[model samples]
Target: MNLGDLAYPDVPTDAVHLLPLGATEPHGPHGPLSTDTIISVGICERAAERLEGEIPVLVLPAVAYGVTRYGSAFAGAVSISEETLRSLVGEIAEAVGALVLVNSHFEPEQVETLRSTGLPLLDLTRRRNAERLTEEFRAGSCHAGRYETSLVLAERPELVHADRMTALEERRVDMPAAIRAGRTDFVAMGMEQAYCGAPGEASAEEGSETFETLATMLVELIREVAA
Candidate 1:
């Protein structure tokens, strides 16, 4: 449901507030810049549909900005400090009795911060639980890859640039390796285009399947938390 719909006074108090957080940044030339937010909203809306009136799941306005330092090298990428991201998420969680974070980006530091907020955070990072779904969809790589491209194609087909996929390159960086070496050298990792994986393989059908599975998983997690 829309955020405006939640403003009704008769709305139930025990409803689980679902906050879809995302970033407004580049996701390769094939995908939309707001891919993260779009994916999050799609999944949240699907989950809310399944829960219906009985679950009182409300879709809050998505956090359109996120921490994207590595991608900042790209022209359209914008990022915030880890502290700012954490504080912002914490404030939102405190405002609601319980929060189900629908995250599309794989920012570990930001995820950890949101988790530490003590809210019922549901991790949907490509590097985490979403990895399995990625495999199922044959979506390779982690960023602006087959999975993300497919999801965007499924949810917002008009926004994708399928013909440009062949020009994009796969640039995978081992974040853990850099972290262990005490070097904040994300730019030097060779991800100049801020992209990884094959965007050309994305399809609307595959995207729909991945979205359905993710929505189901999120709803199940919410039910467990409520119980």
Candidate 2:
């Protein structure tokens, strides 16, 4: 159930609250800046539907911003301190006992910040389904690439700027090593164009299938945990 659609009395105070977290950052030239949020919400929606009558699940309003300092290039990226993110998540979880987290942003720092929440966080980025997609998408660069672009196509096709696909496939950079090497921005990591991976190969069908796989994985996890 959507929290916004319910009155205070109708709110499921005792239900399991699920929170989707995303980053308002650059998602390459072909994808939307809100790609992360779109994917997060999409997964949450599917998971909720799968568990409809089985569990009391409440889909909370998505957190539109996150700790993604790595995408500081080509505009649209915003970030907050790790402490700030932690506190914000903590405050939300405090009110509902615990908030099950679902996130689409894969930046190392952002993932670290979310993990630091000390709450139950189900990160799909590193899951088996995502691992397989990484092979197909060559997503080691960890930015707007085939995987993310396809996800956007599945969630919001109109948001995709198809005219800008594959312009920087050859310039894809390895972000994790760059961060470890003391580099601070996307420009330093070789993402001068603000995206990586084979976005040109992304298709809505691939995206839709990937989403179903992820949602299935999430539902199974929630069932295991809830059991």
Candidate 3:
């Protein structure tokens, strides 16, 4: 059930609450600005469906802004301070004591901020979780590449700029490595078009499969807490 769709009296106290955490940032020229948000919501919704008979689930409204400092060079990139994000998340977590964070944005600051909340989080940046995802994602170059593009394609195909996606070439910049080396933004990390990985090779079939993995991971996390 969606928390936003429920009245005060209808809210379930025993259900595991999912808070979709995402960012509003540029996803190259082919992907939508809300790519991260879309993916987070997709994972939460899918997980909620899977947990229906096993455990009650309530998906909260998405928090669509995060510490997106890497995309700062882009026009559409919007970010909040880590302190601010931590405070906001802390408040939300306090209110919904059984909440779990389902995040799609992988920026370092964002990851750190979410971790500071001490809430159960499905952080895809971790090796164990990242390894379960597609190869492109594990390589850490999938900012708006095949992995993310495939997710967007699976969740919201109409939002993808097909013309631009088809015309683009693969950019294999190791974003995580570059960030570790002190690269501040997409431009510094050699992401000229604000994207990396093989976006041209993205397919909805791969996306659907990836979503299943993500949802499964979320469900497992919820079960660990709900138990």
Name the best candidate (by TM-score).
Answer: 3
Clashes of 1: 0
- Candidates' lDDT values, in order? 0.75, 0.78, 0.91
Worst 10 residues of 2 by lDDT: 130-139
lDDT of 3: 0.91
Candidate 3 TM-score, true structure as reference: 0.98
lDDT of 1 by residue, 41-86 (tens): 9999999999896677878889888877656666777788778988
Clashing residue pairs for model 1: none
Cα-based RMSD of candidate 1: 2.8
- Please give, for residues 206-225, the per-residue lDDT of candidate 3 as tens digits: 99999999999998999999
Alpha carbon lDDT at 87, candidate 1 = 86
Q: Candidate 1: misplaced stretches above 4 Å?
A: 125-128, 136-140, 169-187
- Worst lDDT run of 10 residues, candidate 1, spans 134-143
Tens-digit lDDT string for candidate 2 (1-227): 88867899998756777888898988777778889999989888899898988987888999999888767656787887788888888899987774688888877777888888767777755656466454644346647777778888898999998888745464566665677899887777777778766788788898898888778877876776677
Q: TM-score for model 2?
A: 0.91
Q: After superposition on all CA atoms, how large is the RMSD of candidate 2?
A: 2.0
Better model by lDDT: candidate 1 vs candidate 2: 2
